[model samples]
Target: MKKLVLSSLIGLCGLSLSAQNVLIGEGSLLRGRGYCEPSISINPRNPDNIVAGAVLDAVFYSTDGGESWIADTMVSSFGVWGDPVLITDTAGHHYYLHLSDPTGENWSSEEILDRIVIQKSTDGGQSWSNGTFTGMAHPKDQDKHWAIVDTSTNAIYITWTQFDDYGSENPEDESNILFSKSLDGGETWSEAIQVNTIPGNCLDNDSTTEGAVPAVGPDGTIYVSWGNRGNLYFSKSTDAGESWTEDKVIAQQPGGWDIDVPGVQRANGMPVTICDRKGRLYVNWVDDREGNYDVWVMHSDDGGENWTDPIRVNDDTGSADQFFTWMCVDPVTNILYAVFYDRRGLEGNHTHVYQARSTDQGESWTNIRITEESFRTNPLVFFGDYNHISAYGGRVRPIWTRIQGLKMGVWTSLWEESRYEGEKD
Candidate 1:
């Protein structure tokens, strides 16, 4: 739980905003490995209680908002791998979900990625249960999963990509989005069902059916969106996970989801779905439509039926790339906040983390750089796939990864709603 404090004052659009940046975890960097792919969640009951996760089983908990954090390694009977997704329910219960490696042999064992394992933490992420699992179709692989808790019914829903054969170049191998729900907390889960109509290849690339993030509408309707074959597809399950509507193309991802960003081993433009309190469904992702990657978002007022035109979120005039975007809407204030890696005023692989605040839904954005300073990244080091943000009440915590001196570290900003006066750019 060692703390690395880096505080700064950033000037955005002639407005000076101050934020305290706290480093959650950091470790020595390997050629293609280090701590990255961070996810965060805030408990609505107690905004001070925050929890986040990074790659390879790193768990961080912050009781004093984002000012301080305690880091620990998560373990389970079904071994904890990467792709950590953390979510908190209305009752303040936290759920940590990730891929499993039962044999502890990683890629060497066939049991790796056999299913998605979920661990429940009752005491605000202080400790977790041994864990339960879903989507356990043996011989097939489960990856890239996200979950949402229905506050109305206290039921937890999860969506993920299921591959017939991971990394297989065979044309016959395919990947599809699968979903499951838990009624009694995380004690047990229903049988996993395929929700996507169209399937993609098992290569885990642009054509692969990945990034199926779930969102719950105000009226309890479950909605999900993903990228496949250069199209952003949306689907809904009104009657819970028992049935789902036919996949509808919501947006055309010109450059697909697999983005080629300099100074990173791999990057993704996968879509992230979230619904505000007013039932407005918002989906955020990154794509190279203008020859350079940028964050784009679309909102649907009438569930997943009709959507507004694509709205650029970065608000930068230059063509510097912005990728790996994640969004979340505050239930109390309904303010939409998105975080991503930005290279707007820097050269080459120097990257900075930015946060875009939308007080008027997804219509416009006020972009502000949250990072104290830009860090230069090397393409030889794996930068992970995505960054995450969680907003509860008026508290906003944006989690991201940065490379300094060839070492990787996960960091968060102590950003609050009071810092911004809703001044539109």
Candidate 2:
């Protein structure tokens, strides 16, 4: 097991904010030697069994609640590129999804990124199957994919951005959100369908329609949201993936999803949608509407038809930047928790991890710092797109990438509600 890195003592008069931080590994063979943009999952079937994935074919598995991890690389006949997303179904099976470099000649030819590959493991990510793929539109790049498993039906649903000409500035090039599903434990998948009514440019910037993450509601409704051209849109399918509503604007992102931060290469205000046990939908994203980038959240009580105004999740005044936010609602408690990189109480480019909890939907929030020490990022280095979090049964794990000097690594803050007492010890 890795040694305990740091412990953050957030003393609240009436709330407990005790958290322990751990470094999964750095320069480990399991993490493909070097990596970023990590994704993590806590198995619903077994909370002790946790799995994490990172960019460029790196995977880490821990059977003891992330106390220590064994690093390993992922294999697939389709060829693994990057943009790793880890998810789990109700049957105790874990799935790793990523972009593909099938022919191993992505730079030489356009046929390299031929599809999106999914590899499954039934033994807690010990080993993986060959892999199954979807969205195989040649000459098009499939990137930034996120998946959610419907526990009721054991069906997996995914949404992502498909670029006509990746990074092309040509006005003829296009980018759109795509959706697909797998019903047979990843053996096969439904045909990819376009969900966005208006397509964006293919520059993979603010105009690009990207970050389409899907969430399953209590009644089996699949809800998805993304950003483009300064507007955040939402769409849902009551009849599974067979149909979807035209994109509807739920809120204005003001400066659009793509924004420039001081120390990062690229950053965006991509929306993360999550449904609580009561069927209420919650979305979290970053925006500078308040004169600075801050974590904002909005919720819908009556499904995806309507949403409230954006509520600031960070408690600080608008002076520093808060970006790369991810949210999760505990199914057992229905409490909303958000995690993101915060520069509110720091100097220079130093950033810390912070969490906000809302007991009354999006009406009110309590922000707490989770990182004991601060870390800075370099604009010259690619810092990935987002962070990830998973919470169940009062066990919260927030996973993120941290780059100190020349070394970059992934970390998680172990948050257990049981350890929180009204008074600090």
Q: Against the true structure, whose TM-score is highest?
A: 1
**Candidate 1 collision pairs:** none
> lDDT scores for all predictions?
0.90, 0.85
lDDT of 2 by residue, 177-206 (tens): 999999999999999999989899988788
Q: What lDDT tens digits, residue by residue, belong to model 1 across residues 178-262?
A: 9999999989999999999999999989899998999999899999999999999999998987999999999999889998888
- TM-scores, all candidates, are 0.95, 0.93
TM-score of 1: 0.95
Q: By lDDT, who's the top model here?
A: 1
Query: In candidate 2, which residue pairs get closer than 3 Å at backbone N, Cα or C atoms, i.e. clash?
Result: 30-71, 30-72
